[model samples]
Target: MNTRDLLNRRAPVRRAPASNPAMFLFGALLCAAAVAVTYWAFVRTTTGQLADESAWREAEGAMPGTKLPVLQFLDSLPLLSLFIAGAVVLAVTIKRRRLAPAVIALGTFAAANVSSQLLKRFFFDRPDRGVVTLDFNSLPSGHTTLAASAAAVVFLLASPRWRPAVAAVGGSYAVLAGAATFINLWHRPADVVASFLVVGTWTLIGGLIMLRVTPDWNYWPPGGRGRGTAPVFAAMCWIPGLLALVISVGCYLYATKSMTALGSSEAMLLYFWSGLGLIIGVGYVLSALACWLFSIQAGDQDR
Candidate 1:
């Protein structure tokens, strides 16, 4: 065989993930659990509300003089950004001749966004839990949903070789966008978390379907970048994410020293970082989860 034929012969294909349905089911169920827990913690408990609202109030100009660059980043990724990225997703999928993936991506995108609005408007209710907060439901942030769903589209269409990096960076952007929404007082911490879970559910579903319909392009080749790259990319996301989680917990712990201090500026700022950290850390974790799941499902393709 010539050099080209020799390389093709040696090109390792990953195991088809579609053979096992359990991974997708578990991921979807996990997303549902996360959303339920977030809602219960923030809307059903006084402490949760106090913590959520403290962070919300902080963003209502607690740090009057300081400005964050993240806000600018958020502004940059407006609805127009979604349109552009979505177009790119479509273009790439079409170019690769992956019609099933394209359709699935678009379907999930629409389903996820509609689900968020429907859940917020008609389904979910914020009861008067004696927290003195808004009664209207805002559990799942619309901005976050929009951003994450867009990222999900890209994730679904990406091949295994690139999905790890895409998952980490895209998830970070979407999650950080949620932080901007709450920091600007558009939503609460729970709202952002809820949005992430919502998008995650749909993404998982899409992944499962795509695996069944289009496993041809879902595989990673062996001996190219080596097998270590995927985990490395995932680590790039979750490492900082876990550290932020730790910091957020520490901030919350210190802020809760006294009852009266809960509403103080210090407490409010502390809560601000806490909420930011939660969103960031969760975003990273989810991204890493995607990396891990896809890696396993799309192992060296079946011969």
Candidate 2:
């Protein structure tokens, strides 16, 4: 080869994007801890059981007019639906030449749903908390798992710049599904929270593997400058996420400290909204965290 040609070919190699191993590892552990705490607090303790039961009963009061449509949406998503969604996502990823991230995201989805079922059926059980509930345990809702894991998969496989918008829209759908289950009395508040934590845990684990194998494309625009989606969607997620959490806390504390006599309808409504708040808060907060983490870890893609 000519000397000029050789020199032209000797350009500097760009570094791959950075990954957040610590965030992925400890974030998963934190999710697991949250799941355990949710189960124990809402399933094992008498007060927790009472509160959970109250919320469930209040949800039962929801008219069929309100609950029927939600049931329809939930029923439309059978096991086969998951497979179809998975296949479509896989095909899209492979088309874009992102085989590794696709596999990890899909695996995360499957693992989360399976774990939730196993925990409900074989492992975790409600031990006679004496709150007048049903005989079988149903902690960690199946419906919520299906919905949330589906959302998480899309979020994981998306480009970092698009994650915030995806998170807002997709996370809202998951929360809506979770809330639907709660409203229809299919599951308690604790059950939905457990599913959220389960999805979060699996997502972080998948993210750990995804970062190791595919770091080059896991990046976003650093500032709100040029050709990026405005942080509008991120604000959409953050505002509701923080508001729901604070209001949920207030609902719980108010219920605890209320001068009203026990079991008043008003107090029951408080507990109900509190449970719903947990659903919305945990779901959106996870989305917001994803937005922030990818922005921080992936660095400026434009550079």
Error of 1 at 161 (Å): 0.4
Give candidate 1 misplaced runs (Cα > 4 Å): 1-19, 62-78, 222-226, 260-262, 265-268, 301-303
Clashing pairs in 2: none
Off by over 4 Å in 2: 1-15, 79-84, 221-231, 259-263, 266-268
TM-score of 2: 0.88
TM-score per model over all chains: 0.88, 0.88
lDDT of 1 by residue, 1-303 (tens): 798898778544555443477988899999988898898888888889889988887777665543366566666665655785679676986698657778898899889889989988988888876777787889788888888888888888888888888888788778768877877777898899899999999899989998888777666665434357788988998798898889889878878764534458553488888888888888888888888887778756544
- Lowest summed lDDT over 10 consecutive residues: which window, candidate 1? 10-19
Worst 10 residues of 2 by lDDT: 221-230
Q: What is the number of backbone collisions in each predicted candidate, taken in the order shown?
A: 8, 0
Candidate 1 matches the true fold with a TM-score of 0.88
| Overall local distance difference test of candidate 2 | 0.79
